[model samples]
Target: MPQTLDAAAVRTWCSLALEALGREREEIDAINVYPVADGDTGTNLYLTVESAAQAVEAVFAAHETGSSVPAPADVVRAMAHGALIGARGNSGTILAQLLRGMAERLGDGDHLAGALHRAATLAREAVAHPVEGTILSVAGAAAQAADAFPQDAVRAAYEGARQALDATPGQLAVLERAGVVDAGGRGLLMVLGALVEAVTGEAPVAPVLAHVRHEIGDPGLEPCAAGGPAFEVIYLLEADDAAVARLRTRLDGLGDSLVVVGGDGLWNVHVHVDDAGAAVEAGVEAGRPYRIRITHFDTTAPPREREQVQRAVVVVVPGEGLAGLCAEAGATTVLARPGEPPASGELVDAIRRAHAREVVLLPNSAELRHTAAAAAEQARTEGVRVALIPTRAAVQGIAALAVHEPDRRFDEDVVAMTAAAGATRYAELAVAERQSWTSAGVCQAGDVLGLIDGDVAVIGADLADTAEAVLDRMLAAGGELVTLVLGEDVPDGDAVADRLERYVRDGYLAVDTLVYRGGRGSTPLLVGVE
Candidate 1:
């Protein structure tokens, strides 16, 4: 085993931590009592580590195309940034600050003990009000132990954290009353154990407590305490350090459990408050805030009436317009850049973000089929039932969505959506980049080209004439509905859409045409006949 951290070791640490948390999420969540008593500490830590792992993987991926390996500093920085943006809950936000502190002190890895001390210090500063019998206490104890045993610091830190976690009940009344140790401290111990495993070849065994409290029923659906805050607000903000400093003050006054973590003009703000709108407005005054989430807690629901999260639709689209369209239709849209297609890892990340038991994946580009299928398999291994719909075009995916019924059985639903997508025929209108030979004939560089079902079918000089010819050929095969999606470069005016509609009216009496704006993309227009 390696004695010090490098990019590879850092990557290993992240993966180990995420897997550990995933295994213990429900157990940690069950015993949660401090900081509002919402039993999601384990889930929050898993998500935070998952984000950090993704960022580290991205750094390694960027270097894979070349021969260079990422520096230890680069890996640590990515881990810190990922945790900052993806942090959740009170414990999670503090954990982000701790990781950031380590990033600040990371060097040749000989100073592992020093880095641990710095991390503990930074975490303490990030909290609005530091309390004992929490993750902060565990972090401090671990750092002190590491400082004493610098030769074997990683293992020392894990043992120190586990011992501190055992003493948490004496430090806090809530935990003592609940017959459990601090939940956040327990999670910190789990993370430290992973770090120990990373340094040594053998994994550390988790400590078993004698006075454990096993919470009955689904803890997530339970109500909060009588006098607690009614809402949870989270958002990512873009602002300077001075602005964030002021924001921290404002939010601290507005609510409890306030955490603002990040630096260099980007930060993630999370808080619990009765005035959710006021909290968000304070962020706006400081800087621009987006991806805002506000959830209201209901205390009156019975256990039987508590609602569970439903299955979700996960889709990959090329342009912003299609993303918005899919989002509006209740699908989680992953935007694929013009040239850089999403990898299997990215697709898997999107599936995890969906946070659903069942998922329907729409890889709207033909090139993304294998990647999407691979992602689906990975998700299945993680206990998520995923269905991959091999949609070769955005319009085909749209057609499939139109017929989707999540309330139906999973297999039945997949079959219906697949059939709907398969029944649609798609084509695109583009301008030839250079003189090229086609099925119709050789075409000039500026000539309009109509590609039907992935082949050049009609070539002409005028956009209107070429579109009409393509529509005529498609209608000859007998289609009842025609979808016209216009791109950004298309000339302003309803000329193309109107002319096509008039042509259909003059010849095909029963065909109906619908038009949609496709925003900016490579193709000038996309046609779907169903």
Candidate 2:
């Protein structure tokens, strides 16, 4: 009687799921009792899943006009692929894989018992060492329950997931400390919960997906809410698909809440253009755009300078940890990406959105020095000063954050603060679970990778080797003060430090390292020479 589902149903379900996630998103982040305490876990999951939801909307909308209908199969498949590339940290990676496995099960849109079983089995396989009381456990049990009552109960699948989630804290000691369930697991369950509610005739709770990742912009002087669509401008463009996409992308950097999703062979048209001539010329570069169907949306009769008041913020992350940490850092705006720096337009928009007199960008990854340079150039062109400090690593970003001075003017503090960071060395340890090539040498699965000044200097079978290599480089660079931030996975900070002390026994430098207990990650996990 009941089958896979319809598109309208899916969109409704997706929205409901996002709403539930937004409600309980933080609960998962609070589980870190000690050791590896990074705040981005929950936020990572939220953004990862949110990106998937956004992708679905974009894909579906295009499909409506003959784009492609991505059913359970397409939805999960695209989401998994996108999420994996867009994955932030450990939790985000696992979640992306889980989505991938689920998509495999629902391949070709068979929302039947067999499909459910296949998805469950695939999900279990994705996790190398599956932990109980987590999203995996909850998802596994729900799949099993659905197999048993495929016909008798339609909502059984969602309820099973919820039941499994309820026992999450009991499965992990850390979660028990927080007096809450697993945040990632809860987010997963909540999303599915919405699916259940949708099928059962319960009203779906819609989440605010469109607004969360808005251009960090000055809210403008005021909303056209004093009247209407702000600017009612129109323009016509005659360009190829490539040029149109490029132009569309640039508009994002220039303004806010822009809706310009229409382009074709000859004179493709449609736009709520904020600046008519700029929009038309952007398209005209490739060829000539005519008829431009131009009409400007005017709140002010003569039109006031359409400026948005906002801020730009940059963070260094390797996993979901980046999002959580940035949020806690009092960041008003955030964009999630891993390994590399965000583009020039992304940086410029951030500056404009923040209504920045001078934008401060922290390109935490060392290899991103060039990218930061590009961003700086763009900032300068816009008459906005961009203060970029090479935080080098996420640990460095965290450590340097203590010195952030929002109260001071941009010019004075940019110079003063950067000098402070230049005087210190950034050292961090992460597992070489993935293979990589670097100046450090060929990396293996079990090696503990050591990074110094943003380059891979050591990769060894033990953390001590990597730690020593990173420290030795820092010491050689002649920095008297070194701060080593310890992660959750690391054990015996003092013992490790002592071992290093023995390595450089010929003390020409006072290698004093401070260990702060915290979690560090960027959305793009691969950093430096990888």
Estimated TM-score for each candidate: 0.74, 0.41
- Residues 364-479 of candidate 1: C-alpha lDDT, one tens digit per residue: 88988877887899799999999999999877888888889989988999999999889899888889989978988999999999988888999988888898899989888999
Top lDDT prediction, candidate number? 1
- Determine which window of 10 residues in candidate 1 has minimal summed lDDT: 299-308
State the lDDT at 465 in candidate 2.
69
RMSD (Å) of each candidate, 1 decimal: 6.6, 22.7
* Superposition TM-score, candidate 1 onto the true structure: 0.74
Name the runs in model 2 displaced over 4 angstroms. 32-37, 64-72, 152-154, 201-530
Q: Please report how far candidate 2 places residue 75 from its true position, in Å.
A: 3.5
The candidate maximizing TM-score is 1
